[model samples]
Every structure is written in structure tokens, then in C-alpha cells.
Target chain A: MSTVKQAGGRPRESRVDHALAEAVRALLSEHGYASLTVDAVAARAGVSKAAIYRRYATKEEMTFAVLVHDLREEPPADTGSLRGDLTALAARIGDQIGRSAADVMTGLLADVRADAALGARFAATYLAVERSVIATLLDRAVTRGELPERPDSPVVHALLLGPLFTWPIVLGEDPDRIPKLAPVVARIVADALIAGALPPAAQDGLSGGS
Target chain B: MSTVKQAGGRPRESRVDHALAEAVRALLSEHGYASLTVDAVAARAGVSKAAIYRRYATKEEMTFAVLVHDLREEPPADTGSLRGDLTALAARIGDQIGRSAADVMTGLLADVRADAALGARFAATYLAVERSVIATLLDRAVTRGELPERPDSPVVHALLLGPLFTWPIVLGEDPDRIPKLAPVVARIVADALIAGALPPAAQDGLSGGS
Candidate 1:
């Protein structure tokens, strides 16, 4: 636990983590999440199974670390306007939806449904982290008076992200088209948030609807 | 090919088709799509694989028939008001997102990505059918003056459906909660369609953004 002792070990530990992450990504792209095993990852990464086990208790956890944690940790955008920030964020997301992204997600989600513990872990780790990032962006917009107070964060998050996520995967559109869709996506979100445009019924029912 | 001969044979043929469809649903629920085989479906339905093959060319085609064609053929909602129609439609869709729904969709989509022919068939059959239904609803709204002319159908589709599709599967939320979310979902779509609210830049760019 000593600082000097930890300094030498920390670098090696993180290096192993990186290798394991890379291994997971490679396996996911190649054979998908269902076929990805810890032993295979260890063999691929040139690390021992113990190294992967020490970090993650299950394949789901490993997937969370690689797909959600490492890949989604970019610095939050600040282009002085919410529109610019959202457009940048959208483009970044669109770029990340590589050809194999759908395969990996489809595989991961199938497993998540079958395992309750993994589902909870995903909600806690992946969903929570992603939601927090969006929350931070929305908070900045509110502070700038560019968005109304108490915008329905969950609704906003879903609307902004759902289309981008669905376009390539479910609709089978080109992933490259996401950048072109970004401006429109951003506009839709901004309009919903800024204008009190909820239908009469939902306006009363939802906190963010108004 | 005679009318009397066809009448004598049609009932039995339809009966076999129903059995095959039922068997496919059972297998999909029990073992998922990846593990499901033509042989297993044949055995479960007590029909020959050749009989299945006679009607459908492949397992993907059979899956498309049962999951997409049969289950999705509800009469279009005609609740007078677009809000009423959307609310009813949302609730119906929300109800249908039971536990097996995601698993089935995940499996179908994975297969769709792997097989080019299957993917093309899906776009032609399932995706085309769903889009036309939404388009009809939107057209009704436009006719009613509840929405503007020439709304971007695909964007509107994504926005309205993205949340409903995503919340239960990705976020691991309760499927039942989608009904509660429907009114809000409907309002968001309706607002985006009616008000022409758009971010300044995208307003100038997109057709309906302004």
C-alpha cells in the first residue's frame, strides 16, 4: 500500500488491464460476446487467466470494462453552445458505431437478458456512467439558459441516443450516415427541451414534459 | 390446381403452417434463435423438415413469417385523435415487449447481419411493413392537421420508437413501464412534428426543421 511500492506496480497493473481490454475487443469483433471466453482472452492477450479474473468476475463485467468504460471516457464537450456540444457528441458516437458494434451489442444484450446479476451490473456500471455524462452536458446547457430547468433527462437521453443507436443496427442504415444525422438529431433534442411543446395529456403527467 | 382440389387441400396445408409457426415460437422461447434448428422445429411441430422447406426456403424465412408477419398484424389503431391512436399503439407495442421479444429480436438481428440474403429479406418484409404502418399513422395526423406536411418519417419513426425499444432492452427497465412512458413518447413525436421547432443552424438545413 505504500506510495513508492504502488507506483512501480500500478503501471504494470494498468498495462495488463489495457492488454486484457484489447483482447476482449478483438475477440468480440472476431467471434462476438457469446463466443468470447476469459481463457481465450488470456491466451490472446498473452496474459494469464488469473489476470483477467483478478479484474472481472465474469464475461459481462469484462465486456462492461472494455466496451463501456474504456471506450466512453472522452472529455465532455464544451463548444460554448449546446448545439455545438451535442453535434460533436453525436458525431463521436456515430463514429464509434463500427461495423461490429451491432454484433457485439446484440450478443451482450442477449446475455444480459438471460442473467439477472449481469443485467444489474450493466445498469450500475455502463448505464450509470453514460447517464452521468449526459447529465453533466445537460446541466451545462441549463446553466447557460439554453435549456429549460429540469428537462426530462431520461427522455432527453433516449430521444437523442435511440435514433443514433437504431439507425445502423435495427434500420440497417450506414454507420457513416450518423454524422450527417447529427445536426438533425441535436436540433430535435434542443427543440424538445427548449420549447414547452408537450401534448396536453403528457404535459401534466411528466415532470419534464412541460 | 382446380378449385375443388385446392379447397380439399388448403385447410390441411394451412393447419401444417400453423403448427410450424407455433413450433418456431416455442423453440425461440425455449432455446433462442442461435440454437434453434430446422430439425428441432420439424420434430417439435411433428411435421417433416421437407414440409417446412416446401413453404419457407430457410429458417430465417420461417422466423420472418411467424415473428414479423403473424404477431405484428394488429389492426391499425383508429382512435379518432392522433394522440389517442398513438397512445393506444404505444401501449400495444409496450405490452408486446415481453421477455421473449428481445431475445427473439436479438437472435433474428444477429442472423440478419450474418446473412446478406436474410438481411435483405428482412428489410423487404419486416422493416418495410413496420415503416408503412407508421407512415399511415403519420399521414392520418397530417390529414387531421395535428401534424405538418412532409415530416421526416424515418427520423420521426426513430424518435418515437427508439426509447420504447431501448428502455427495456439496453437499460434493463421494466417492460410494463413503457405504457407509462407512451404518452410522453407520443407527445414528443407530436411536438416535433407540429411545431417546427429546430436549432438555428439545423433549421436552415433540414426540410421540416424550421
Candidate 2:
């Protein structure tokens, strides 16, 4: 977690941090979030408990860091068209689905539901970052007149992601089904946009006391 | 879990069972799935550990049984039009959301993700039941010619429930919002239906090796 060690050419301090993060990811893949313990992380990483505690205040914080690291690795997709961008996003999301990510996500869902502060942090950090990416994509489409000027970004975001998110959790639905289904989902979303399902912005002067 | 005691007019066995189930629900609400133990449930229920063991084979089994009980209490939604039926279904789903149900569901997600057998059981017993309810509603719509002869029921079902399910899990979204958002979601779904977003059936001779 420190840059000084790497600058000094020692690399040991940074190695411990990387080891701890990798350990968290490995354990999450194997055991999921419920059974993960800090002590076990230290043992698996070959680091001391003090080292783990020095870096992260809580398990949730550590997990969030790992997720952020993973998120940064995903290149931003800009395909020039709303349909292409959304479909790319879907494929990116679909690529993220596997045993490990799904397991971590299932565990994260519980953590998010149980703790409000943690949930807010997740929303701000992970969810918001992704949403902004989508917003930017949609904004470009708006400039091209492919979308409304003030489309309901949040609703569109939900529509785009809801099925992908729900598929694994809901029984009998395949998480892998997203790739095949992304085009259809994107088409439906584009249709919603054209039909003006997006909420009217306040600046549109549509407000009333009704 | 046994009905024999009621037949004898003693009611002791049935009381123990009810107490155990209530204890499970309470503990689930209080501590979620990971922290709940059979011994703790026995202590909370004022029943013997052996009695608890006799009823359920494992913690997953017990939790699944509680979910099934809750599911049974939800009456099926049926209205004349597809829109009306979907809206009613959304309302019923919205009404079922609360602290306890959310807590239990959060716990179940962890369990289902961790254990394949338990996840499948949940899918089979709980998810399948709800799907059947949606299927029945959709079937009536099809009969009335409101829907095509061969519709993609799963996609329609996914569209109907995805947003509702995503809310309260993702930040800043409300489960209760589904009631208000139902019509909008149903409208998009209806549009998809007419636009033929649904995959055509194989019986229509569309299958090919291409």
C-alpha cells in the first residue's frame, strides 16, 4: 500500500500488500465472502496479522480495494454507437462472470445489504464509476441525435444491467446467457430510449404541483 | 416438522416445530445466514438440539423450508390484461419486501452462492414456484391474444423482475419503487413483445446449423 518501499527498490513492503490482496482474491474464489477471515488471509498470504491490520481497517474495506483494483483493469469501451457501446458493456460484464466473480459478488451483495455505510461506499466507488462510463457513452449518442438530450440515465442503466445482474441470482437462469442475450437487451433499451421512456429533466419546464 | 402430535391432541411436537421455525426466522433476521447455527436455534427456541437435528438435515434445509413457507403465503396475481396482471404481480412482489424478508434473502444469497446443492434446491423449490405463477399469468394473456402464440416467457419474466430485484441491492434504489415503476417496466416489456424481442420457438422451423 506504500510507494516509499517501491521507490527505495526494496519491494518487500509492496510484495506483502500484493500478497495480501491476492490472498483475499484467492480465498474469495475458493470460499466466498461468508467464510473468509482476516487471520486466514494472513496465513495464506504468509504475512503477519499486524501487517494485514496495518493496511485495512476491516474485511469489507479490503474486499472493496480488491474490487477497485479489478475495476481499474477493465478498459473503458467506446464503440461510437449506443447499441455497440451497450453491447460492449454487456460483454465486459459477461466476461467478468465466472466462478470467482460471481462468488465474490454474491458475498458482496450480503455485505452491501447488511451495512449501509459500506453499501454507500460501494455505490459511490464501483456503481457510480460504471454509471459514469455509461453516461458518457449515452451523452455521445445524444450529441449525435441517436438519443434524447436528457435521457433518464439511471433508469437506462438499470434496464441495461438488471437482467445481467438478476440472471445468476434467479434460479434456472444462466449467468453465461448474457452474451447471447446482450444484443436483445440492448435493442430493447434502444427502443425504450426512442419511445421517450426516459424521465423528463426539471430544466425541461415540465414541473407542476400536481 | 411432524404432524403426529396434533393427531394425538398433545400439540407438543407441533409447538416444538413452530418454535424452531420461528427461531430460525428470528436468528436469520438478527444475524443472517453465516452466523446462524443449529445449536443457537435450539437455544433460542427452547428446544433440544436433538429435536432440531431431527427436523432438518442441515442449516440450508432449514432456511429453504422457511423460504417455502413464506412463498406459500403469497397469493397469485391475476388480472384481465397483461399490463394489469404484471402490475399486480409487481405490487405483490413489492408488498413482500421488508426488513425481515430482505435480511433472509441476503443470507440466502450467500448460501446459494457457496453451495451448489442448496442453490439448486432453492431454485427448484422457491424460484420455480414464482416462475410458475408468472407463467400462469402470461398464459392467460396469450389465450386472450394479448401476446403471441409462442412467446419467450423467460425473457419477459426477467424484464418484469430484474429491476425490482436489482433495487435495494444496488445503492439508492428502493424495492418499493417497483410498484410505481411497474407500468413503465411492463410497457417496455410489452413493446419488446410486439417488436419480437422474444426468441422464436423452434417449432416455427427457425432452427438451423448456421
For each candidate in turn, the interface RMSD (Å) is: 3.3, 4.2
List, residue by residue over A78-145, the lDDT tens digit for candidate 1.
88877677777666555655434766766667777666677787677667766776767777877898
Clashing pairs in 2: none
Which portions of model 2 show Cα errors greater than 4 Å? A1-22, A29-32, A37-58, A61-77, A99-101, A201-210, B1-78, B98-103, B201-210
Cα lDDT of model 1 overall? Answer: 0.66
CA lDDT scores, all candidates in order: 0.66, 0.65
For the record, the alpha-carbon RMSD of candidate 2 to the native fold, in angstroms, is: 5.8
Which candidate leads the pack in TM-score?
1
Query: Per-candidate DockQ versus the true complex?
Result: 0.37, 0.34
lDDT of 2 by residue, A105-177 (tens): 7676777667767767767656776677777777878887887685655667677777666766554466556
After the best TM-score superposition of candidate 2, give how far the Cα of residue A104 lies from its true spot, in angstroms. 3.0
